[model samples]
Target: MNKVTKQNALRAHSWAGVFLSVLLFLVCLSGTIAVFHFEFERWEQPHIQEMESVTPATIEKAMDTFLTQNPQESHHLFVVFPTSDIPRLVVENDHSAYFADQEGNLIEKESVSFTEMLVDLHLYLNLPHSWGMILVSALGAILCTLIITGIVAHKRISRDAFKFRRGGNGQQSQIDLHNRFGLWASPFHMVIAITGVYFGLAMVVMAVVAQVNYGGDRQAVMDQIFTPDPILAPQVGKPEIGKAFAQMQTLAPEKTPLFLTVHEVGAPEQFIEIYAKAPNRMIYAESYRFDTQGNYVGVAGYEFGEWGKQLAWSVYRLHFGDFAGMTSKWLYFVLGIMMTMLCVSGMEIWLSKKGHPVLATRLWYSVVWGSVSALALTAITDMFYSGSLTVVFWCLMVVNTALTVAMKGLSKSVWLMISGISVLGLLVFYLIVHTTASVTIASLQLNIPMAVYVCWSLYRANTLLKRERMAPSAKAQSGSPAQQTPA
Candidate 1:
């Protein structure tokens, strides 16, 4: 490549990295944590009574009881049969679902999980409707730019493809680590960037298309894309849920129905749409429709369609790694951590540049370290506190950011130490509490994984701190006149 081109590419990469690093770090970290969201749900409500077998009869009875309780509501009902992982028959009456005991007695209301909340934050930063998605999309675009420029900037891409120079000067070492990770993980990084952008930008693009082509009716676009034929009004018959469910079972025997929605319930025009799980597919779920009287209608088709719409439909599974089971989740988790590190190291690169001021360093440290500390604190708070997880998360974010900003230039090492200590202590305390108390096996199983992870993080942080402390002393000792002369 030409010198001028190389220089320009390097400059572009450095600027883009500086601009998007913090946001990307936040997104990646949250995405990594969100990989185990369902497991966390199981963790949160271990006391709920569980059953080995869930029959249609049990679910039907539970639904009947739930419907009777909320008789005033005129909407569809849903009953989630218990599974091996989560062994509670959950019944919903429009607003929310509640877990039931073995005898169909109401146990407790299911609350929003912390991991799910984090997933939402990762995707939208918890902003209102479409706006948050747009912002996240913009970040994705920035990431794309960063990736393209980063590739172009590396002139000796081949030679340095697998090179990781250890124990070099700090700048050289950082550069090597950055390049090594970027090279090795290029494909994974591309997948994450594209999928992440697809998720974030989907709504914006849909909204625009809807506005331009469908007179600003987004629902109209969705209907055209997803829904099948509208069921006709039944002349003189009542809807039969059991018959409709049976038809669905016959048609899609391999897949189980996750939920069913009856549009215009109790009306002659009402139709039952059953959303069934696809064991090994990229599409979110295959939907089947039936009339009020449980007559088989049709299946919603996305397989044979315009590439753009088909691509958009597939993005959700690709982005979340939900199409694949635990193996894919683990792959995404590892890639996510690498991506998070890329963001952090990118920022460090910018800070290491000549003529960069102390203020920039302080800001970078506060943002990076503050976010880490905030996440650790959030996990701790979720485990101990019970009131409102959403409230506690926001409060922790506010407090961490404020502290970081306020304490800038006052020894980042000290803050890091305190964060490490707090995380370690909380994890140890949680482990002790869980072990000592008479909790269910399910709860213990969930808590143990998190406890082990926290302990590992604590040990890692402690080791790094020790090495950092010893570095200056070793450097001073090596640089001494007598030692230098002898060497």
Candidate 2:
């Protein structure tokens, strides 16, 4: 009965992996890339003057300048302060965002962020907010299911801890690689899955709870989980940004203000909020509240909040492995690759079991490799075209699929080879685009990853081609008796 249960668990795990293959891959890959979100921002807008700290007067000046341009529309205001990765100040409103120099001079308008768009894919699969998040959370649930069942099925996990085979046939090689990564990094994967599920389902859960207890007062429910968004009203006096900073120094001197947000400009109910990050806190940043006159309100309690609240708020950092900075992000990036390959290999095993249907295999390769090719190519084109990258990416994927369909009787490996070639081409294109541009730390941050991935893509493509070339020879050497089949 125990053995049977284990077999059932294995079956369930494999089936779940098959069911969630593509989405899981998309989420994991985007998340891996998004580890460099701040760096991407720097790369996106390098023209802005960067500094360690911008004065409160400078922030106020930038805010005033922007608001003056649009007097009729009082959009919610956001100020993104300089960080280690993004060493510049940015102000965002409803319509668009622009960089502010150290002396509060409004710099050029910021461009659309492809890196952030990629992050959105991980967050919501680039779907509409509510539905996308719910669906992504569902993927997280499925991941947890896979993890539990996988452990059950691999009951001899400890015994097989050191078991890894390098050169073998496809399934055996894949199994070995999968088990090694899965078992070794199981804890980290579990944390990622749980936190991912938390973020994915958090809003839904809040809405449901709001419906049940608060009579569908969504705002009330939100107030319980988060500090409420400030109310807007007509006002006379301006907010003192410098005063607020002075108070925050006394409140959280150990922390650095990451961003400052003014909820409603020129309104009686207007408020200023600063997101400050302390040295070793897991929560992204704690909100420090202030009135328009810069009089300090209390902290949002995230930094020294209740344990449950603190844990709840730490989900984003835990999910993306951002807490430990670059080192942890690198670890996550590698694990993310492993996780994506795990998805592909898991599907590969399932398809091999199902007689390796040519149709399914081809479509799988098209979606996985083709999407990667699209992302790279989109970055390349973004330098030249002012079109929407989201649209551009999906269009590229559709084109890739069409190419797959058009090429009759070709192996799926061709798509991978093409993807590798496309990636290499993109690297060249990126170099060409930035050749004459001023080099910054952000450029290194972006280009180094591209170089690494080009090599990764090349390795994958070569491996696929080598396997394709050896397939017929492998079949011929299998020692099957062609003549004895007559008997």
Candidate 3:
């Protein structure tokens, strides 16, 4: 590439990273944690009974108990049976989830808001529905642009593959770290970006498809690719969930049942969809539909269907890294952190090339470190308190950002230390709790990783604090400010 072309590519890369870096950081970090969303849910309420297996009859009894207690007719009820990952029978309605043992005895009603909060943050940054998805998808596209631009602009990227420098030049060290992490994890990052766009922009795609192919009948388009609603019939009898489960086992014994959803309860159109996880399949699950009489209707085409149907069903597993279980989760978590680092260091590169305004640097610190602190605050609060957890999280983030900005002279290292301590504090809190089977395992899962992270944070914080210059200066250059400024 020519000199001018290389410089323009660099500017484009910088522009992409600087504009959406913070939002990308937020999404990536939350998504990393959301990889263990089910475990987090288990941690939130661990005392709920967990068992390896439950009889079909036991499931029916639990559903009956729930219906008898509620009295009011519910539109639907979902029963999520025990699995290796989440070893609990969870019965839920629109409002709340109820836990039950293998013997059909009710344990308690609890909410897993911490996991929900992380999901919301990752999925939409908690924006309103339509705007949130659209914007996040747009950011995904920008990330793709950055990926291409970054590769194009890095003239000696291959030569500097394993370079590491951390001496007098802060920008060089940041760039090295950024490049090392980014280059190693580039494929994973690309996978995440493409899959993320598919999920985030699905509704928009669906709308366009509806207009072009389905005469603007969105439901018709959806039904073609997805499961259609069951035909309405006269209300005859209550669904025998146990019978359905028995028949399902006979139908697909190779698959492990995950969830059973009863639709339109007490209505003529009522039916059941039993979700079963197929072994060694990329598709998340295959839905086994059943009629009101507990007779098996058929399996949803996701398991044995055309290419389009199978591909559509695979989206959830592919995007969330749930395809291969624990190994996939760990891979997703590590790559996710690398993506967050890329966002941060990409912005730092721009700052080093141009100028790092004190306000911009402080706000950057507030965004990065303050978010770390808020996550711990909300997780600890969710464990202890019973109010609205999302509100608590948003408020804590605002307060942390305010404090970071107000303390103008405080170094970013101080914020890092504070967040590190907060994380350790959260670990201590988790330690003091009454640990059950699920809690014990969940605690171990998070605490071990968190310990390593806290150590890294402490080391980074100390190193930064020891620096001669608190804020880095722009490098001496031959170019003018106009060339230095990103497009």
Candidate 4:
């Protein structure tokens, strides 16, 4: 409220933004794109047969076929049913996965490596899950810090709400845009931050909870939070999956069965668990349990459980905007882009104030645009090469930064141009590769928008280049360094 307090808040806000700028940008960008991960998965293998529904017998046959082919013991087996969003049946185990046809035949081994890479990057920063998640989640907490401090720092927040001042080293414009974005999106920002923290810190919280309440038994804590596994006897043949499917119709007629999991496969405690989505509800799924003989056991109670349990269950959908179908997904996508731009603009404000140091600016440009380029490169690689996408991604990132800093007089716009060209090239290459096959609706849905983005990026790059070219002339006439600086 006071001048000194506001100054301190401003300092903290700037410091935190600079501290986590790149990581924050990386996470935000990946997460924004990761909103379409399901589409990406569908695009990855558009040739697969997609069906609206598969019969219970078909699922049974597919399971039998999978088991017969792979005799190796598996801890768990999963059969993901078709939905309006992702209309493909996927049968997988802990070790392998395959797409299944209407006739119950296993098709190609499922390959959505690129989409997985993108999602993993967003979720774990491509680091080992144990540690990367903690670091990413810490960024979320810092985001909250930045948000609060930024709000406090803005003394004339109400009057400045709609203000925009261009020119003069572009610092004023950057500040105004950053402040406006932060202010307007504060609610969304807070939700993302809190949910983001919960994902990774959840493990730590559970561990502490287990220590305090369950004698350090994490499973006990889990059992308390989630539905406990149903008890079953040793005698069993193949699980009565068809019968279980039939029983679900009567058990939870209002819910839609999303997937079925066979827990402790081939073991004494093996049972069928069906995860069904409840209509007009946010909980991820309410799981229904059945014995090997397909006798209905009970439900997971997520829909009718304690408030905490329901809240915990709903976090994924709420965080990812997966609840209301494509409309919600698109809304999240737009807001996510705003969030990603917030990260970039936050750093831009700091960089403008710091006079945009050459090395820092170039490195930052490499990170910002290079990430875009590398994602395209990796996706191109995934089309023909089945290698470590994470390695390719990071290696390209390092190379981009090296080249950007190494090349003299290279403007940041060039990197943007490169990013646009690379994405366009990826699109062209994909079309060429799949020229023989008919492009599915899934591919068209993503590719068309991607083309539009490429055009926009290229246009932006040209505009920036023109501005940079005129900067010197503008400086000569105005005799002001601030006037000559490009935004």
| Count of steric clashes across candidates, in order | 0, 0, 0, 0
lDDT of 1 by residue, 1-487 (tens): 7888889988988887777677777777887777767656766665567777555455556666777676766656666655543556787766777887777667678864666568777888767647787777778777777777888889899888877766755777888888877777877777778887777676777899999999999998877666645757562344555577667667988875666676666666678777776666677667778787778888776544566556767877677676666677778778877778888887787777755466667566666666666666666676667766556667776776566567653344545555566656655655665554415766665556555655665676577667768989999999888778652
CA RMSD (A), model 2: 2.9
lDDT of 3 by residue, 253-365 (tens): 99989999988887888898999999999888999988888887887778888888888888788878997889998888878888888888887777767677777887788
Q: What is the C-alpha lDDT of each candidate?
A: 0.70, 0.78, 0.82, 0.89
**Residue ranges of candidate 4 with Cα displaced over 4 Å:** 436-438, 479-487
> Which predicted model would earn the best lDDT?
4
> In model 2, which runs have C-alpha deviations exceeding 4 angstroms?
211-218, 228-235, 408-413, 473-487
TM-score of 3: 0.91
| Winner by TM-score | 4
Compared with the true structure, model 4 gives a TM-score of: 0.96
Alpha-carbon deviation at 219 in model 4, angstroms = 2.8
The C-alpha RMSD of each candidate to the native structure, in angstroms, is 3.6, 2.9, 5.5, 3.0
State in Å the error of residue 275, model 2. 1.2
Model 4 worst lDDT run, 10 consecutive residues: 433-442
Residue pair clashes in candidate 1: none
lDDT of 4: 0.89
Q: What order do you get sorting by TM-score, best first? A: 4, 3, 2, 1
Question: Model 1 — TM-score against the truth?
Answer: 0.85
lDDT order of candidates, best first? 4, 3, 2, 1
